[model samples]
Target: MTTFSITSDNLFMVSLLFLIGLLMPTLQIAGGQSIGVCYGDHGNDLPPAQEVIDLYKSQNIGRMRLYYENPGALQALRGSNIEVLLDVTNDKLQELNDPSAANSWVQNNIINYWPDVRFRYIAVGNEVIPGGSAQYVLPAMQNIQSAIVSAGLQDQIKVSTSVSTVVLGNPYPPSQGSFSGDALTYLQPIVQFLVSNGAPLLANVYPYFSYVGNTNSISLQYALFTSPSIVVMDGQFQYQNLFDAIMDALYSALEMVGAPNVEIVVSESGWPSAGGTVETIDNAQTYNANLIRHVAQGTPRRSGRAIETYVFAMFNENQKDPGIEQNFGLFYPNKQPVYTINFPQ
Candidate 1:
C-alpha cells in the first residue's frame, strides 16, 4: 500500500519535542479519537497538503501535529475528520505576547481557516525553555496565552509549549525530577496559566537518546518495553517500561509543585529508522510498533495509568535542520512504511 501523494521534501520537517507538563483534555484510550502524529515539515519538495490528507485517510490516522499553521495545509484538511495541533517558532515570541499581534496572527492564519481544520491545540513554541541560546522563557508563553484568549480560541484550541529532556535537572530515576532553576522562572508561570485555561502540558520524549547516550547502562529490552517486570519506583509509583518510567518522573515533578492533577500529554514520541550503529532499523521498528500497541491497547503501566503517546512522524523529511539523526519517519518520502509500524489493529 504505497501512498503516492507524498513528495521528496515531505520527510524533512517534523514538529520536534523536547519538554513537557499541565493538564486538560478529552483523553481516552482507543475509541472515538485515539492517535496523534507529529507532522513535522522541514522539507520543500513534498506533495501538496491535500495529497497528504488523502494518505492519512487511507491509513486511518485522525490526529496531526504540525510545526506551524501553514494555511495551505490547514486548508487541505478542512472539513476532514482530522484534528491538528499547530505550533509557533521562537522568532515569533515577541509578537506572540501582544494581544493585537496574536489576534492578527489568528485572523490571518487561524480564524480565517478554522473549523475547516478544527485546530484543537496551539503549541506556543517548540522547546522554548531549553532552546539553547534562544530560550524564550516567560514572555513567549504569556504571548501565546494572550493570543488564545483574544482570539476566543480557548474553547476550540488549547494553548501549550513543548519542552525537551534537556530542560530537566534530572530524569533517569523517574522520581527525582526537577526543572532546571533557570527554567522554573519560566515554567512556574507557564504551568500557572495552563491550569487556569484547562490546557495540557506536553513533552516530546525519546528513549533513543538515553540508549545512545549511555548504551552501557540502558538495555535495549528496557527501551523497547520488553524488559522483565523487576520494577523501579519512586515512593509509591512503580515503573516497568521506559515510557511509564518517564511519565512517572514527570508526574513526580508535578506533585512536588502541587499540580498533581495537571494533565501531562506525550506530545511527541518515536524511534528513528536511520542513525548510528545502535540506532538501527530493527530497533526502530520494535520501539515504535510496541509503542503504538501500548497506547492503542490503553495498556496500563505499573503506575496504573493508561499510557498515551504520539508517534514521532508519518513521513521522512529531507530538509529538516541538520542534527544527530533527523530522518526518523515511520514512512519514507515515497509513502511506504519505513518498516511496518503495525499501528494497532
Candidate 2:
C-alpha cells in the first residue's frame, strides 16, 4: 500500500481553517445580540448620570451611545465596562475640521477617561450630510480620524458618522438603491474613508418611517418583521422584512460607490410606544423583541456575520417634540422599562 505525504503548505492551510473555525463562535457572541442603548438626555426628569449607569448595569446593557461628551456622564462610566460611542455635534463640526482642534477635543473629551470608560467609537456627527450642514461632514471626520491616529489610538477607537434614510433615493427593490442629488457628491468620499479605515457605515434605519410615510405600500407585519406575509422580490433575493431590505439597499448603495465590503451598523432603530398613528405599547414590544431575535440570527445576505445594533433610546425624551419624537424610548424618565424585551446577558 502506498500513502501520500502531506506538504507544509497543505498543513498551513489546514491550520488556518481550524483557527477560523475556532474563532467563529467567539466572534458570533461578540457581534451577536450585544444590543446597545442610545442614552439621549433631552429630558428634564431623567436621573443623574451615576444612577443611569447603575440602571444600565442592572439591565446587562454593555454598550451606549452618548450624543456628546458629558463630563459628568463620562465620570459615571468609570470602570463600568460599557463600550461607549461618543459623538461630536454638527455645530462643532466646523471647529473639529481643524486638525489641532480635533486633537484638543479628543484629548479633553476622550483621552481623559479612556481605558476606564471603554470608549470604542467617535461618531463625528449625526445626519449632517445632505442637509445645510453637509459641507462640514467629511473634513470634520478626516480631522477626527487623523487626530485619533496621531494619538496612537486608531486601533482602539473607530471614527464614523450616522445618516438617516433620507440619503437614499427610493431604496425600494433593494438592488436599485443609489444615492442621488447632492448626497452622492458627499457620500462617495465618506464611504471610501470608512472602507479604508475598516469602519462600519453607521445608519439610523427605521422601518416605522417607511410604514407611516407610505401606509398604502408597507404593511404592519412586514414593517414589524413579524412574518414574511408579503414578500418583495429583488432579482432572486426575497425580502420578508423592511429592516433587511433597507440594509441590503444600503449595501447596494455602497456597492455602487465601490465600497461593497464596508460593514453596516444600525446605530438607531425603534418604535414609538405612543403619539404616532399605529404606535402602541404592544407594537413597540413586538417590534423590539422581534428585532433582537432577528439580529441574533443575522440577515440572509450577511449570514453568520453579526450586524451590531443599538436600540434608538434609553428614555422617553420629554424635551423632544411633543408627539412621536418623545416616545421612542424603551424606558420612561423614571428608568422604568416601557415594555418587557429580552437583552443579551
Candidate 3:
C-alpha cells in the first residue's frame, strides 16, 4: 500500500474522517428518526419561551409535547418546524363534549396555528381513565374529530388521549396484558375511536415508578436499560429492558381489545435525577441516552418500526410537589442539562 506524506491540509482531513467514523454508530442508530420531549411549564425559574425554543433547536430536538396551550410557547413555536403534541387539559374534557365548544376550542388553539405550529397529535386528556373525568373522553374525542374534519385538518392532526399504565389490569408476562373491568369500560370505546380515526393511542409508560413501587422485584439494571442479558422471556419475544416489555404488553392489550392494527405512541417515559431511591444523575443520563438510541429499533412485537416516544419534561419543575414529581426533567430550569445525554439528530 502507498501512503501520502502528512501535511497540514491532509492532516485536517484525516482527523475529520476519524471523528466521523467514531460518530457513525450513533448516527446509524438514530437512522434519521428523532424522539420528542415533553415541555412542561410548572416551574417559576424556567427560561423564556423564545429561549426555550432556541435551546430545543440548538439540540436538534424534532418534536415537542405541551401539556396545555400556553400562548407564549405556542407563539414561539410558530414556523419553528418542531412537531407538537398539544393537549386539552382534563378539566376541559366535559366542555369539549359539546361539539360547538369543541369547534371553538379548536379555533382558538389549533386553527390559528395550523400549517405553522406543525401540530401532529392533539391529546384530548391525560390519565383520566379509571377516574371521574373518564366519562367525557370519548365524547370529547368525537367532537374534536368532528371539528377537525369540519376544518379540513383531520388529515393533518390526529386526536387521542394519554392514559397511564395503571389502566392495564395484568401487564406481566407481556402476553397476559389486559385492561381491568373499570378501565376497559372506558378504554374500549377510546381504543375504537383511535383505530377508526387511524390515530395512535398515547400511553405514559414509566418504569421508574414501577421499579420504585416494587424495588425488590425489579432490578435497577433492567429499569435503566443496562441489563447484560434478557431478563424476561415471553413466547418468541425476548425483553432486556423494561420499556420494550411494557410496550409489548400494551400491544397485547390492544390486540385483546380487537384493535391490533392501532399504533401506540409513548407519550412520556423518564427517570429522575434526584430526590428518590435509585434516582441519580448517572442513572438519568443512562436511561435517557439509551432511550433515544433504543426507540428507533422498535419493540419485539413490532420490529423494524420506529416507536414515537417523548421523554417527560424539558426542565425540572420546582413548583411540583417536592420530591420525584419535580425531578423527571432532563434539563434544569436554568436551561442547563441536568445530565449529559445525546438526542438523535
Model 3: CA > 4 A from native: 1-32
Worst 10 residues of 2 by lDDT: 10-19
Alpha carbon deviation, residue 124, candidate 1 (Å): 0.7
lDDT of 1 at 329: 81
Per-residue lDDT tens digits of candidate 2, residues 204-316? 88888877776555667777776434357667777777788888778888888899899888888888999966787767776776676677666656666666788888999
In candidate 2, position 117 carries an lDDT of 88
Which numbered prediction scores highest in lDDT against the true structure? 3
My TM-score estimates for the predictions, one after another, are 0.83, 0.89, 0.90
Ranking by TM-score: 3, 2, 1
Q: Put down candidate 3 lDDT per residue, 175-243, tens digits, no spaces.
A: 777887999999999899988999999999887777677555666667777776777767898887778
Candidate 1's TM-score = 0.83
Predictions in order: lDDT:
0.65, 0.78, 0.82
**Number of clashes in model 1?**
23
